[model samples]
Target chain A: MFNYIIVGSGFAGSVIAERIANVLNKKVLVIEKRSHIGGNCYDYRNKDGIIIHKYGPHLFHTNYKEVFDYLSNFTDWRIYYHKVLAFIDGKKVPIPFNFNSMDILFPEILSKKLQEKLLKKYPYGAKVPILKLKKENDKDLKFLADFVYEKIFKNYTIKQWGKRPEEIDSEVTARVPVCIGRDDRYFDDKYQALPEEGYTKIFERMLSHPNIKLMLNTDFKEIMKVDLKGKKIYFLGQEFKGKVIFTGMIDELFAYKFGMLPYRSLDLHLEVIEKEYFQEVAVVNYPNDYDFTRITEFKHIHPIKTNRTVILKEYPKDYDPERDIPYYPFFDKAAREVYAKYQELAERFDHLILVGRLAEYRYYDMDDVIKRSLEVFEERIR
Target chain B: MFNYIIVGSGFAGSVIAERIANVLNKKVLVIEKRSHIGGNCYDYRNKDGIIIHKYGPHLFHTNYKEVFDYLSNFTDWRIYYHKVLAFIDGKKVPIPFNFNSMDILFPEILSKKLQEKLLKKYPYGAKVPILKLKKENDKDLKFLADFVYEKIFKNYTIKQWGKRPEEIDSEVTARVPVCIGRDDRYFDDKYQALPEEGYTKIFERMLSHPNIKLMLNTDFKEIMKVDLKGKKIYFLGQEFKGKVIFTGMIDELFAYKFGMLPYRSLDLHLEVIEKEYFQEVAVVNYPNDYDFTRITEFKHIHPIKTNRTVILKEYPKDYDPERDIPYYPFFDKAAREVYAKYQELAERFDHLILVGRLAEYRYYDMDDVIKRSLEVFEERIR
Candidate 1:
């Protein structure tokens, strides 16, 4: 009898299995349907001899020190921080719209004056609103906002969000802040480094311990007939005997009796370029004129010594039932109401737990996931 | 001589100017380079008589009752929630991968086993690590993680991050969770809704105050020469008599003395389709198998009653100093170190204040920007 039968070898399942096995020295079995480990974060050199992430681009950024430190134990560190740029007005400016951008964007006199005005308005650590002109009755002020909207946010927001500016929340406009100074950093978190060797190394190290067992290219159904009794169940399969652990979605566990929830999926196209570098930055956003949101280059993320580079052109498409690796969990009210029904059904079970982004139906960063998993482990194991 | 000088007339600038002018009875002069208002969030009808966001799509969502109530003063609210879907493997799945996806994605026996295993493992609210199998020594458990990684993440990650999963961060893997159940909703927020009329209408009302003035096709540089002598200066020009407010880039403000900060850029290609609706969801993500990110359809975002629809194809590219808009700021350690120098230079000037995401060089959601702006407004006005 296994101490725990964990399902899905993704972040949630892998982390729990290792922790439980390491802490209690119990026997753990991890089941995966695909042909490899590391779940969605797995990476390897492709036929093009370029390092690639099978799932998608994964940049690590967290404000939590413990999460960073914990992951650091498994893999070496790389001092890489993600960068994003947008092609607009036929010019390249630092993303998040910064002060340095003005030099390249606006004429000398206009840029200078605009700088002075922003400085005075934002004295101290003040943040000015993008909707500053919204409540104005003055024709001039209103006109001014209209001008800025047309030049800066209007086109970009439309292409990105698929809605008009006024239709969006003022808060939405607020996300794109006007900068007073010249800082052009993509992220402002203290911890913006990358894994030195790679994420795969970390997974390899994390799963190298003795107490755990793994099955690749083997679905949970393969083990369904195995008798599971008297074991501290960590089942990540269809059936659980004792203390089964699930890291999948919460709604499907109950068989969607409350109706189907929504999710956003992704489709990617990749190519290998015969050059040392394809683009200077890691990712570039096309806000104004594109159906797609952005494109990514591998050299920026991997920094390999090979001359051949790989790039990914991403296109967003509707999620269909027949084909997709359901990625983003849709958490709208209707879906939530449906999910609530499933949650109620799940509550009926005494030995089952739902976890992770899919199970909880929340948008969580990497640190949050680890933090959440640790919290559960601390509570149950001790 | 100008009685009142307004900097940006977007939502923040326009709203504040309108409020101050109406409440304080002051004359305001608003200057704008672009021919329109609403800043980056502006919207209008195009040649097809279809309302569109000239810049990009925008969606409005907020939990703050005060914000909703405030915006409600302008236009009637549209009872619409944002929805997104992703097309993967020839199927359209709801975003935020849900339970119903299981039946569509996996074989019958495998799906059943996966559901049961996930439930058993996640019993009683226990959150497990998806990367747990990587830390296990058992060969079978390790294989499970590897399998899922290849099918779900390996190819996708390579396309998204431009790096192999091993080279990327495990935290990123943690960010993408698999759903055991199937349900599809785009966002998890309960307050997700859009304005019924559109963003332009709301802007018109927000900036209708009497004291505020309007100026279209007027750049900030043109107004710098018209100086204010005695009163407290809210300088929106290059040179100021009193206080100056800046909302541009910080590094360029002082010139690229510390060397140009790194940033990513993009290029976009847009097209108009005659169809009533292009896709089912608002946005779709392509993590693999594409050079571009995804395609966006305007009809889905706005849902206006029209026969013509617009769509855009997005492409991500490197930021050239001469081309593109700085949408995302790159936050590498090197960039921050350079920005630190600029920050110190900014501190020396007491008459200038830097504000917004541009000045701060941080990633903020729409609500956070509004909140930040409000905080700054409270500090300045009071």
Candidate 2:
């Protein structure tokens, strides 16, 4: 009865659902195992009337104007430039190891020398990843790179990925950069802001189209039977004539033909406190000292005026398929080889489409997820 | 028979018990209503092996060398200089409204002007209370004072004390100050550190004296009866021979004859996160925005190389006499008057000694509480 059946209601599926209903005038059914929409992006007003992200803090930021503009259609924006601090050597310094951070961490003479070297080497306001910076010929630059790598990146990488920085892909370390200038904002994006009325509200607006039928707390595996050889998808024992869009784990979709793909899951410790605020910044990274990765104070991101605030401490753990939801896909060489075989198998059915972070087996920011969903809709569904 | 009977086994009672047993060489019985001995200062390793304060984050910092030296006898120290950041207008600035904060908050011209004015007005490194700074005649200084009072002090006071700054005692406002210099450290105490193990460890060592008898999960009121007219105290309906030291709420002791004294209670939300760390600092203050006052990442205070971290969000609520433990006394005029009456009632018995924050109806930092207990032993019990 549906033109397209989408599994999962996160940014990937929801964005596709909205486009199918609105752009193509097609009936779309979105099946989500979670009780709420927005997948990991799910946020709700807690008992104390503070809007909190059930997972962790997700800041909406993008260099892509199309992605930003598309999302703007769903919700108004509250311009929030996110800033992060790393706790190093008993001091809270601006992260990305910017020039200001250089001044804070080192003595006056060393700081000035470092600042001069950094500005001369890198363009003003440019972000240089630690690994790239480490290759610099100068001793001071090498020392600065090593210092950041040890103090801010080394332990955090081990805790986050359960591997050393050198073991992981260079792309992973490249994501966290050391800035040359004094800009403290975490992301250097053209568009950076949170949804005016939380992320959930935006999802509500996007999925409000009459053609989009949403059934949450329903897993696709419960009803849909995939016949890869026959190239037929059956729902509730009947052959499903519509196109199938699977946004969940690719390994689970194929029943682990190439064995399970690895992922890093997170245990979020959330608390509602009595005070109006908690921390100064939206997020603070503890790379060298603690067991957890970071602490996020929700009020700092949302900027709601209330008597109480909400905070989440994020602990990274090895993803157990039995217990935890798949968060970050492990993109190691072994994970890639396993994913490649799954990708080849998924190609057997023309009607079956794989999209989003989980299906693609890649990490994505909010904007990239939206952009990916838009591409899937335009290329396959249309 | 015990030589001394101590009620409420927190810092006050524990310090006195240690002194009586170790210094005075006499048997001391300590009665605690809570199952733990540290009272509000209690901390323990949670299920995740992260040391968390059962009550809240209690950073030990004091200018009194004697207080530091005395506590050093019990536990080793991990020097932790406490730093706090105030979330104001989407930026995490150093608290105490220092020169660095001025630079971050205002424009370049305004920041320089304010910096010059602040240095000229107040001595370098001196913390000027907002009320005292507001007394400055210059417009720029007046604006700075008003700005800090409005941005940082006002809402936090209202949430903390349920009062406006002027409504509360000047002493309360005076406690939080604005520094003229760039020093971001919260306190300029002579000694600032956490117990190398944990606060609970220190309490364990302090109360380990052979002559000290600890009876946890037992309230003094349950076993002891005070006869003001007879000038006698009875334990389990029998006459008690030694001096009685009460550290509980003074109003509760007198059965609230002059009406109950006001106090604030905290609801702590604790979670074990997967990350190695959470916030950049041990504590972050949300002055303007949320209902909860602050979030504390415990590992930053007590650093141990582990894979996960623990954090606490503290919510402030009105003290429910039936449900909540009194954390902070509401030192308004009417509450002071009520406490004075309780003091008068207690003065009748020469053998009964009142000590600790609750008994005195005052807030004392950890070191001050220890100093007060030492003074009580030398001046009265000795």
Docking class of 1: incorrect
Model 2 misplaced regions, further than 4 Å = B1-382
Cα lDDT tens digits, model 2, A1-382, are 4678899889999999899999999877778776458999998654343568888888888999999999989888989899999888998899878989988999999999998988887789888888888899999989998999899999999999988788988778788789988999988888998888788888888877767766544567766888866878887567877889999999999878779999999999998788877878989999978788999998787665567788899899999998998888888898899999999989988789999999999888788999998988888888
lDDT of 1 by residue, A122-171 (tens): 66334345477444565544543554566567876665444567665443
lDDT of 2: 0.84
Mark the 10 consecutive residues where model 1 chain B has the least summed lDDT.
B227-236
DockQ of 1: 0.01
Against the true structure, what is each candidate's TM-score?
Answer: 0.46, 0.51
lDDT per residue, candidate 2, B119-209, as tens digits? 7866888888888888889999899989999999998888887777789887687887888788999888889888877887778788776
lDDT tens digits, residues B1-382, model 1?
2344555555555555555556556555444444456765687654343556665567777777666666777767656666555555666555444445555655777656656666655453233344664455645434435544554456655655445676654545665544444435544455666666567777667665544455444445433432223222323233444334444456655556567766545566668787677777766656455776667776676565556677766566555766665554566567678878877777666554555555566554444555565555457532
Scored by TM-score, the top model is 2
Candidate 2: residue B108 lDDT (0-100): 98
The lDDT for every candidate, in the order shown, is 0.60, 0.84
